[model samples]
Target: DAPVPSGAKGTYALTIEPLTAIPLYASRTLTSSDPSGFTVQTLPNDRGLVSVPSTSEDLSILQK
Candidate 1:
């Protein structure tokens, strides 16, 4: 887990892994239940990595 700064915004990187050892397409889409709290940023190539921008208010409550 990542720590969200108090009253600040931060980003976290998420690594996507395949269930099997098969080659998959590079283009993929990600979604979040709370779009306002978490935003997904996809990277280039099929590295299976994504960036998530999170808000302080959204993460603060998680610690409670």
Candidate 2:
């Protein structure tokens, strides 16, 4: 993880690539139950992720 300087803005990209080709045969559809209109999501929400600090931090404080 890379942290931007405090009080500064930074742009970063986080990418994930699988070693095995994702099976094109597997797929699923998600739809909202609301009857007012049509709403659909075609992809799963689980994008592999990790939590990290947004700015440089004094992690040593944790040792106290």
Q: Count of backbone clashes for each model?
A: 0, 0
Screening candidate 2 with a backbone cut-off below 3 angstroms (N, C-alpha, C), the clashing residue pairs are none
The true-versus-predicted C-alpha distance at residue 7 of model 2, in Å, is: 12
Q: Give the residue spans of candidate 1 off by over 4 A.
A: 1-8, 25-42, 45-64
lDDT of 1 by residue, 1-64 (tens): 2334345556644466669898644333444555545444435443445566885557767789
Q: What's the TM-score of every candidate structure?
A: 0.24, 0.21
Tens digit of per-residue lDDT, candidate 2, span 1-64: 3333345566745444456887433233333455644433334334567766688778898999
Q: Name the top TM-score candidate.
A: 1
Q: lDDT of each model, Cα atoms only?
A: 0.51, 0.48
Worst 10 residues of 2 by lDDT: 23-32
